[model samples]
Target chain A: MSVRFWRVRALAMLLALFVGGCTAPPLLTAVLGPPLKPLPVAGRLRRPVYKPYHEETMTYNLVPPPKADWHAKLKALPLTAAGGTDWVKALNENLIKPKPGLDAKAEDEPVMDLDVVLTPKDAPDFKVTYPHKPHTQILSCDNCHTGIFQMQAGADPITMEKIFAGEYCGRCHGPVAFDPASACPRCHTAMPQ
Target chain B: MRQAALWLALLVLATLLPAAQVSAEQGDIVFTRSSKEEGADYPPATFPHYVHRMQFKCYVCHDAIFKMKAGADKVSMDAIDKGKFCGTCHNATIAFGPTFESCQRCHK
Candidate 1:
């Protein structure tokens, strides 16, 4: 064989090893538990490298955990770890407290206990039960009231198109809270057969 | 003697400068002067500066919507109902309206 052919063969072997190293981890780990110790190559023909699955990547944030046991604290809360963070749940559970103002001692307005049930004319199955408890817990009544929604039921024409466009519920849903685009059951809890 | 006079002028300007500039840290403001008889009888609306500041930036209400000075803006129930001053937001839509039932929410 020519010198060029020998060089190409060596390069192909290196490429094969690189690809095998990247793809062989999960298959190897399943068959055998994580590698216990590094292999010592005294007279080995080829060396094999094993990659360990990083447990840290599964954590919510890459930032270092606080000195306190935050794992226990977060685990206690009703957070949708698989889904996005449900801020409303955190507020409801008192896991996180929002001050009415900059003053740590400032009093917040009383929570208005009201639930508006909206049965969209088009899709009554996806009836939306808009709870005031979560909203009034942090925001003042004036925040929405007659501006975005009227006090009377069936007053405002709410549509999915409008919400996705960043109007009405879309104003805060996508920007601040869990995205409504992905999470439909959050609002449309009244699904009937 | 000239230096003393100049110092007096400077002192007066210092006090008056803030009135014009409108400090954001002027905590709560109570509206008292009302032209209507019913307005005078009702408790003055206590505007919680800290509460609003948390929700909105200073520019949301300052200078354009409301003059920063205490007495600069003549805020009354009528003016508010007409969509001026507090009425701009408190029109039973944006914020809680300055309604008959909601008088205590702010006045308190």
Candidate 2:
């Protein structure tokens, strides 16, 4: 065929292919970008073109479990996982044996102290200085009360053993939230300041 | 004769229909259960009309929390604790979940 005639035919064919959504046959190798590679699994590929089910297009901020003390802001707190890490033992240790200073008695008001009630049932009427304003200022409500504190105050029946397990103060002081050892006496003061 | 019979049936049906049929087939959400048993009468503490209107859109609790249309959301105490139905908000913020046992707050 003549050069001019051949060119016209090729142009028309290209136009038809474009309209039909048809492209040049696949080459043994890719013309532009690198050849597609197999993807990871878990990580499964439902699509033929290796479109990943969980390609993890973006990184997400991992929410390290919920803090406990922020919970007490509520009128009452519950006694479940929400119960400030539900670690009464660790909490007792921190409160009674806090870092050298930052002691519970550091606060002026007795009612505002971070001292523990120890036994809610035995000392039902024995309300102690909670030192709430200072703590709340520094931490979220769950820091002391545990996640469940929003439901009730004397809620967890908080015990030293429980606090150690990371229920009350342990929720933060233990490992994830805060290092109970950082200043054991700071929160768990041996004596009132 | 057939037409007459059909007409009679229609009239009877119309009369049988109660006036002002309740839109909420499920009725208003009530916390109390039928039994007087100590733990019986509380069903996740109903989500009142006022509360729903105040906190969120009809869209959120509708299809997601409850099926669209009125009186369709089935909020169970166990489910709320598991973070379903009312649990979506209650566990997160609105209120505590069933897992937390603050008897007076919910039961009362």
Candidate 3:
């Protein structure tokens, strides 16, 4: 065989080894079977609380032992009158002890509220009220200052398109903060007819 | 044959550079102090390292404000109020103070 042929064969084998090493596990699982035990009948049961047949129901009790109840105990504590789960209140009451000077100020305390009216030229009807007080309560001025919005007014070219695309207000609104879709009145309080 | 091997090595290095750059640019890191103590009155404090990193460099707290090792520094609310831990920056003037209302911001 020519030297060129031997070189090509060696290269092909090396490439095959690399690719096979990367993809072997999934391929092996498909050929054989997953090493995991069959899921419990309770897990396999369909939603809407349907009762399974004798064979299906037999494995229901075979489900893994319950996890520690510490999470449940924490959830049971009454933190707020609102009834829904408030992780902050739970953490405060159960986990976090009040430290001197770390106490949050009263809501009625004299705090500056910079409620800016954002009226886009394209959509003059929808005016967004940018509430600064609530945001400033948790975030530093530099969080948004200079990075997202300039300190000067009329400097930020904020558009709905840019916001939806995860720019400007979209940073917190869509993900961890608030639901941007349904929470219209939260921002757009002033709607022109 | 030698030329082919050289080209392969160059290709591998080229792929690694962009991946390294992406991770460096991401900069977002969440620090949780759950390991030190569990089931406290509050959830473990979750420090948004990325949020701070955007304005400040890593060295600002890596060794100066906070120790490099996890669970090394004992941080309390009192410590923060005395301008020790988070209070150094979150003193209302520099950043939002560690007030009662702002407890959830970090506790979560």
Best model number under DockQ? 3
lDDT of 2 by residue, A109-183 (tens): 122345434334554333333445434332333223334354455555656577677566554344333354444
Q: Residue-wise lDDT of candidate 3 within A7-67, one digit each (tens)?
A: 7767765775566555555565565555453222222222223122235564423442343
List the candidates ranked by DockQ, beginning with the highest. 3, 2, 1
Model 1: per-residue lDDT, tens digit, A61-146?
Answer: 23322344333443454645336555567666666555564344567777878888989887788899898987777666666766
Stretches of candidate 2 off by over 4 Å are: A1-193, B1-28, B31-38, B41-44, B68-71, B92-95, B99-106
Q: How does candidate 1 fare on TM-score?
A: 0.41
Name the candidate, 1 or 3, with the larger TM-score value: 1
CA lDDT scores, all candidates in order: 0.59, 0.39, 0.52
Task: List DockQ, one per candidate, in order.
Answer: 0.01, 0.01, 0.04
Better of 1 and 2 by TM-score: 1
Per-residue lDDT of A143 in model 3: 55
Which 10 successive residues of model 1 chain A have the least lDDT summed? A44-53
| Model 1 stretches astray by more than 4 angstroms | A1-78, B1-108
B1-108 per-residue lDDT for model 3 (tens digits): 885786567444333332111111122223445433333435556665434533343334545577533456888765777788777877655565565435556665
